[model samples]
Target chain A: MLAQGVGIVETIVVLLYLLIVVYLGYLGWRRTKSAADYMIAGRQIHPFVMAMSYGATFISTSAIVGFGGVAGMFGMSLLWLTFLNIFVGIFIAFVFLGGPTRRMGHRLDAHTFPELLGQRYQSKFIQVFSGLVIFVCMPLYAAAVLIGGSEFIATKFGVGYELALLVFSVIIAAYVVMGGMKGVMYSDALQGSIMFVGMIVLLIMTYSKLGGVTAAHQELHAMANVPSLFKGIGFKGWVTMPEFGWGQAKYDLWWIVVSTIVLGVGIGVLAQPQLAVRFMTVKSKRELNRAVLVGGIFILIMTGVAFVVGSLSNLYFYKHETVTGKIVAKTENIGVIAKKKRALEARIPCTLLHIDTNNDGVADVDVVEKGHDVVRDGQVVLPASKLMPAAEVKDLGDGMVEVRPRAVAFLRAVVQTKDGWMFNTDSIIPTYVTQALPGWFGLLFLVTLLSAAMSTLSSQFHAVGTSIGRDVYETVTGKHGHGIGVTRLGIIIGIVIAVLLSSYARGGYFIARATAIFFGLCASAFLPSFFGGLFWRRMTKAGSIASILVGFVITAFWLLFIKDEEARAIGLCFKLFEKHSLLLDKPNWAVVDPLVVALPISIIVAVVVSLMSKPPSEEHLRKCFRGV
Target chain B: MLGIESKGILAVYLLCIASSVLCVVYGLLSWNRGETVPDDVKW
Candidate 1:
C-alpha cells in the first residue's frame, strides 16, 4: 500500500524536541559540580522544578496509555479517581509527606528513600527491606512504562513492535543514565509542561471532534442498554458501576478504580524512593510550601488533563465500538490516525507535529513499541513537497494544504462531510493530542509528550540506580561506598537493566496493561510497611518483614492463580500453578486489588509483633515523625 | 479531593486572595529577598 505520508512541519516539531532535550541534558552536565550536584542537583532545585517534578513523576505512560485505555474501555466516572490522584497523590503527599521526609533525611544525613527508612528505624534490616521492595517492584513499573510507550509506538508505526520498544527504551535509558537527578528534574519540569498542555489540547480536541460535550454525552447516553446496564453506580449485577461496597469484587474495573489504580500509585507515591528524594533536593520548607500550591496546580493540570481526556476516549471508543450492534474494541484509533498523519509516510521520525500527513489518523505513529494496525487511508497525496515535485514546488504557502491526488480527495471528503469525527479509540494519548490540537498546535503537542516521557524516564533511572547502589550494596556490606562513583556505576547498571527489559517485552500491549496490576501489587506490599512505620511506634522489625513478605506472597498467589487473565497472558507456567492453586475462587478474592485484604493483615501483624518485642525508643519515635 | 468546606468557602477565598495580593505587592516592592521570607518558613 502507498502509505499516507506526514507533513514536514509535524516531523520538525517532534525532531526538534529531541534536539532540545539533548541540549538541556548537556546544560545540566555543565552545571554538575560535585557528588550532590549529580544526585540531587546539589540540593538546590528551584521550587518550580520541584513542583513540576512531583507532578511529572506522578504520571507516566500508565496514566496516558494503560489506565486511560481502561477508561476508554469503561466510562468517564473514573474521573473521580483523577481528582483523588491530585488531592492525595500530589497535594497531601507534598504538603504532609515531603517536608517531614526532607527534614528527617537532613537530620539522618541520608540520600536515598530506602536510606531514610533505615536511618529512621535505626535498623539496617529496615533499609534492606525497603531496598528489596524497590528492587523487586520497580522493574514492574518500569517494564509497564517501557511496554506502554513501546506499545503505543508499535501500534502507531507499521514496523515490528518489539523493535519500536527497543528504540524508545534505549533513548530513555541513555539520557537518564547520563543526566542523574539534576538532569531528571530539569527534564521533568519540561515534560510536565508538555503533558499538561498536550492533555488539555487533547481534551478540547476530543470534545470538539465529538461535536462538543453535549453531543458526546448524547452519543454515549444513546447507547441502547447503557442506562439500564449501568444505572448510576453501586448496582450489584452491573459490574460496570463503581463497585465499592461489594468488597470481594474480582478483577472488576470498579474495584480497580477505587482501590487499586488510584490507591496503588497514590499511596505508593508516598513511599517511592525516586519521589521522596525530591523533598531533599529542595533548599527550604518555604520552597516546599510554595511548591505545594504550584504542585497542586501542576498535578491538577497534568492528571486532570489526563483523566478528562481519558474519559473522552470513551466517546471515541463508544462510537467505533457500537458501529452496528456488538461492542467492538471500546477504544478508538483517533490518536493513532492523528500521529501517523505527522510522518512523511506515517514513518515515525525523530519528531513530528500536529497532523498525521498519512491519514491513518493519530499524531506521529504512537511510540512504536505498542503493536499497531497500519490501517490504509483512502489513497495518499504522497506529499509533492517531500518528493521534491520533479521541479521547484512553487506557490506553496504555509500550513497543510491538500493539493495532490490522495490528499486532495481526503480534503474534499473532509470539506464535504462533517458528521463523524472521532479520535482513535486506541489507548495512546495521541488520539486526544491530535484531535484536541488546533492548527499549528502540534509543535507544542510534540514538546508536551517529549517532556512527559523524558521526565518519567529520568526518575525511573534514579530509582533504579539508587536502589542498586546505596540500598542493595549497603544491605550486603556494612558501610557506605564511594558516593559519587557508586551512584555513577549504579546509573550505568540501571540503564543496562532497562535496555534489557525493553528488549525482552514479548507481548504487544502486555507491558502497558500489566502496569496497573503491578502497581496494585506495589501498593499491597508497601502501603502497610510505610504506614506502619510512620504511624505505629510499636511496629517491630519482625512485623515489618513478615508484613511485606506475606503481603507480596498473597499478591503473587492472587495474580497468577486468582485472576482470569489466563487467556490474556497465556504461559506454560500457569499449568504448574493451575491445579495447585490453594485457593481456586481467588479472583473472587479480588486478587488484583489485594490491599483491601493485605493491608489490614499487615497492620495487625506489625502491632502484634511489636507488642511481643520491646517497643521502639521514644526518641526514635519522636525523631521518625519529628517536626511534622 | 479539592472539596472545600461549604461554611467558610468564601472566607477562605477572601483570605487566599488577600494573602496573594499582599505577597504579590511585597514581592514587587521588597528590597531583600531573604527578608521577605517568613521567619519560620522552611523552603
Candidate 2:
C-alpha cells in the first residue's frame, strides 16, 4: 500500500543519491593517509561539516519515524524533547563539553572517546572496558537504526527485508571501512543537508494542507475528546501535557512520556559516545563554538519539524474520510464462511478492531488484521476474520446468510468511535504521507529517511570500529600503529552483527525503545565520569572506574529487573520474579527510567570515590587539562 | 499563544526557538574568543 504510486522517478532519485554518497566516500578515502585522518578526520574538519555530521548522526530514523509516531499518539508535548535536543544536545554539548574535549583530546593526542578517557585517567582498564561496552551494546542501537532504514526501503520499493538489510549495510560498510571518520562525516553532511531541506518542505506542506499553523493547532486542540485508550492513562489533549501525578494510573502517561521519552533522551544525549567523539574531530575550540550555531538550527529543524508534523498528522487523518461501513456476510456454510474470512484477512492492513461478541456493554476482544486494503466496488471495505471472534453469522434461509447486526460497526484509522477500528500509530506518518502529500514529496521524504538512517549507521559503525581498533586492540595487544587494518575488520564485524540483529528485531515501538535503552545506558555509565573528567580537577582514575562500573551495572539491573517496558520485553524479570517487573507492586518505580536512578547514584559514587581516594598527581592533571 | 492553550507546552515550544536563537547569539559573540594557539602543544 505504501508503494502504490512509486515508480521510475523514485528509483532514479535513490540511485543518483547513492552514487553521490559513494563519490564522497571516495573523496574521504583519497584525503585520508594517516591514522588521525581515519579516526578523527585529521582534526581539521570544517565547522559546517562537523555540525551537520553531528546533528545528522544524533537524530536518526528513530527520531523521525519512531518518535514522530509517538508524537502522533501523545501530541505536541514531545516538543520538550526538541527543546532539550537543541539546548543540551547541540548548544551545551558544543559549548560546555566540546571545547574542553577538543582541547584535551588534542593535548593527549587521543583518537577515540575511549582513548581520550584512557589517556586522561592513565588507565588501560578504563579504555578496554569502555570499548567492550560500546562494541557489545552499540549493536542493539545500530540494529534498531538498521531495522528502521531497511524496513522503509523494503516497503517503499517492495523488496525483501533481508535484501534491503544487506544492501543498506553494505553501502554503509563500504564507506565506513574505507574512508573511516572522514568518509562518514562527509556523507553525513550531504545526508544532513538533504534531511534539512526535506523537513522544511514537509513542515510547509503539512501546515498548508491543514489550513495554516494556528488553524491546524486549533483544530487538533478541539479534537481532544476523540475517545481512545490513551485518555485513560492521563492524556488530556494534543496541545496540552498529560495529567501529572503519581501512583497507579494517575501519572502513568506522565512518567512514560516525560521520564522515559523526554528525559531519557534529553539528558542522555550529552554522554552518547558516538556523538561525543565528533567534538574531538574538529581542529580547535573555535570550530566547536561556531558549530553550536549550525548544530542548534539543524537539530531544531530535524526534531522540531518531525514532532510538529507528527502531531498535526492526526488532523489530516481525522479530516480525510475513506469508506466506512458494517460488514455483512452472505453465506453461512462453515467452509464457505471460513474461506471468506481468510480471504478478507488476507486483504487488510493490520488494524485494531473493537467488537462486542457477548450481549454485554463492553468490547471483549481486539482483532488485529495484518494485510492489504480490501477494495470492492471502488471503495475500501472493512475486512473481517476469525480474528474478530465476536462477530457471529446467522442463516436467514433461502441460501442467504448475514452477520449479526450487533457485530457490525464502522471503522476509521486511529479515530476510535464507540465501535470502530484504529490504525497502528507507527503507520500514521507513512499513511499520512501517501494519502496527504504530493507524490514527489513522498520520494523526497523517503530520501530524507534514508539519509537519516545512513548518517547515523555510519557514525555508529565508525564508533564501533575505532573503539575496537584504537581502544580495545591497542590496550589488549599492546600495539598502536596497525589500527587501520584492525579498524576496517571491526567495521565489517559491526556491520554483520547489526545486519543479523536487524533480521530478527521486529515491531514498530522497538526502534524508539531500543534507542532509548542505549541512550539511557550511556548517560548512566559515562555521564558523571565524562563530565567530571572535563570539569573537575579532583576526579581520580579509581573514581571514574567505580562510577562507570556502578552506573553500567545499576542501569543493566534496572532494565532487566525493574523497568516494565524493557524488563517485560527481555522476559528475564518474568522468569526470575514471576512478574513483568520486580517493581510491579510499586506505584511509579516500574515506569521511571534507569537513567533517573543510575545517573544520580553514579555522580554520587564519582564524588565519594574521588574524595576517599588520593587525587591524581599535579603533573598528570596538568597534562590532561593543559589547554582547558 | 499559537493556538496551544497549555502554558507548559507553550513554554517548551518557545524554549526550542529561544535556545536556537541563543546558540546563534553565543556563536557570534564567542566565534573568535577561543581561537588562540595553546601555550603547551607537547604531549
Candidate 3:
C-alpha cells in the first residue's frame, strides 16, 4: 500500500485553517489588555466557551493520537477511561470541585492554581513550591502532547519528526504568547468543535467499513488467542475486559487496565492544573453546572471515538494485512509482489535463493534456518526482516529448494513494517485515515488532530507560564512588573523545553500512557492538597506542604525506581529492585500503577499531618469554604 | 465470560449523544439568567 501524501487540496484546506487560527489569535490579543484578562479571561467566560476550552485542553493529541493508538493495541477496554474522563474530569471536577475553587480563587484574588493554594494556606512557601513543581514537571506533559501532534504530522505528511515538532510548537507558541487565556480558549473552542466533528466522521467511517460494530468485534474476537510477549498475557480479544485480582492470580492486562489506564487517568483529572483552572475561568457555579453535559459529551466523542476507531483499525489491518504471501518463488522471478497492493507495499526486500530439489521444471521451496527445516504444512511463510542477518538456509534433502520474500520491497515500505501490524500499532490510525478516507476528508481529519494538539498545547504553555510568573517570580520577589510579559517569556522557555524533551520521546511510548503518567503525578502531588485545602477546616499549612511534597516525591520515586517502564525509559534506578515492583511474581513484575499507591499515601499523610499540627486559622478556613 | 453486549455499546452511544444535546439545550435556555458579573471586576 502506498502511504498517502498531502496533495494540493489537503494543503489548501490546512492553509485555510491556519488563517482562521491566526484570526482567532488576533481577537484574543485584542481582548487581552491586562494581567487579569491574560490569566483567567477576566473570569467571565460563557458556559459553552468554558466547557469547550476545558474539554479541548483536557483531551489533546495525547488522547486522540497517543491513547487512540493504545486502543488499537489493547482494544475497547480503554472505553472505561472515557467514562472516567466524563465522570471525574467533568462532573465531579465541575460539580464538586469547580464551585469552591472559583469562589475561593475569586475571594483570595488568586491568579493561578498555586496562588490559590498559597493564599488558602497563608504560606508563600506553598505557592513557590507548587510553581517550581509545575515549571519543572509540566514540560514532560507538554512534551508528550508535542510528540502526539508531531508524530501524526510525521506519519501523515511524511515530514521529519524534528521539523514537525518545531513547526507545531512555534505555531502554538505564537498565539499563546500573544493572546493568553482568552486566545487559548478561543482557539480551543474552534479546535474542540473540529475534533468532535472529525471524530464523529471517523467513527462512522470505521464502523461502516468494518461491516458494523458487531461483525468487526466478532472478527477481532476470533483473533484473541495469539501469543503475547508478556508472561500469561495473551489477549482474550478486543472487546472483553481482562480479569482482575491481587498478587499472582491476575490476568496479564489486569494491572494495566485497572490501575494504570483507569485509576491513573480517572483520578488524575482532579488535580490537573490546566483543567482545574477552567472552573475559575467562568463567573459562577451555574455556568459550571451547564458546562458539565457539554464537557461530558465532548469527552465521550473525543475519547470514545478515538478508542473505538483505534481498536477497529485492527480489523482494517486484518482485512488488509500488509505482509501477504503463500507465493512459490521461481528462478525467473527473484522477487515476490505484494499480495494486498494499496499504495504502500511491504518493504522487506527478500530475494529468492533457488535450489533444484527434484531437478524438474518445478522448484520445491523450503525455508531453513541453522540447518533446521523452517516449513509449516509444506509451505513456508515468514516475515522477511525478523530472520535477517541471523538466518541462513540449510541443505534440505530434496529435489529443489527456494525462499520467498514476505512482500514487495518498496523503499517506503521498509520503514512501515518490522514483523507486521503488532509493532506498528501506533501508526494504525494514521494509516487507516489516509487509506480509508477520501483525500479531501483525510486532510480535514489531519487538521482536526492539529487543532487538538494546538488547543491543549496553548493551555499547557499558559498554565506553566502563569505558574512561573505569578507563583514563582512575583511571589518570591514581591514584584509584579510586566506580569503578562513575564508569562509570555515563560511560554517561550516552556516551548524550548518541551521541544527538547520531544526529541527524547521516541520508541513506542504511547501518548495516552505518557499523559496518564503526568495526570497521575499531578493527582498525587495536588489532589490531597486540593481536597484538604478546599473542604477540611482543620487542614494545616504544614499538612498541605507535607501532602504535596510526599505525593510529588513518592510518585516520581515510584516511576524512577519502582515502575519498570519509567525507570527503563529514563535509565534511572530501574535496577534497584530485585523485582521492579512489589506486586506479582519476580522478573516481569505485573503490578499496580504509581498513582494508585501515591495518591492514597498522600491523602493519608495530609490527614495524619493535619491532625498532628495546629488547625488552619478561622479566617483562612472561612475564606476557602465560604459560599460552598 | 460473556462478551460485551452490542446493545450496551449502542446504549452508551445514544447516552453520550443525548447527554451532549441536553447540555447545549440547558445552557442556551439558562444563559442570560445566571448570576450576572459586574462589568469591571478584575479577577
What TM-score, to 2 decimals, does candidate 2 have? 0.86
**Which lDDT tens digits does candidate 2 get at residues A208-311?**
88889888888888878664446667888778999998877667889888988898899999989899888888877888888888888899999998889888
Which pairs of residues have clashing backbones in candidate 2? A347-A372, A348-A371, A414-A423
* lDDT tens per residue, model 1, A129-244: 77766766576567666655654454434445568666776666666667767777887777777777776766676677777766655555444243221233342221124445
Ranking by DockQ: 2, 3, 1
Name the runs in model 2 displaced over 4 angstroms: A321-424, B36-40
Ranking according to TM-score, highest score first: 2, 3, 1
State interface RMSD in Å for all models.
10.4, 1.9, 4.9
Question: In order, what DockQ does each candidate have?
Answer: 0.06, 0.62, 0.25
Q: What is the C-alpha lDDT of each candidate?
A: 0.54, 0.79, 0.71
Which scores higher on lDDT, 2 or 3? 2
Per-residue lDDT of model 3, residues A364-419, tens digit only:
22221111123468865543433321223333334322232221101112122222
Q: C-alpha displacement of A291 in model 1, angstroms?
A: 1.9
lDDT leader: 2
Candidate 3 runs further than 4 Å off: A226-231, A320-422, A574-591, B1-43
Per-residue alpha-carbon lDDT of model 2 for B1-43, expressed as tens digits?
Answer: 7878789988999999999999999989988776533345652
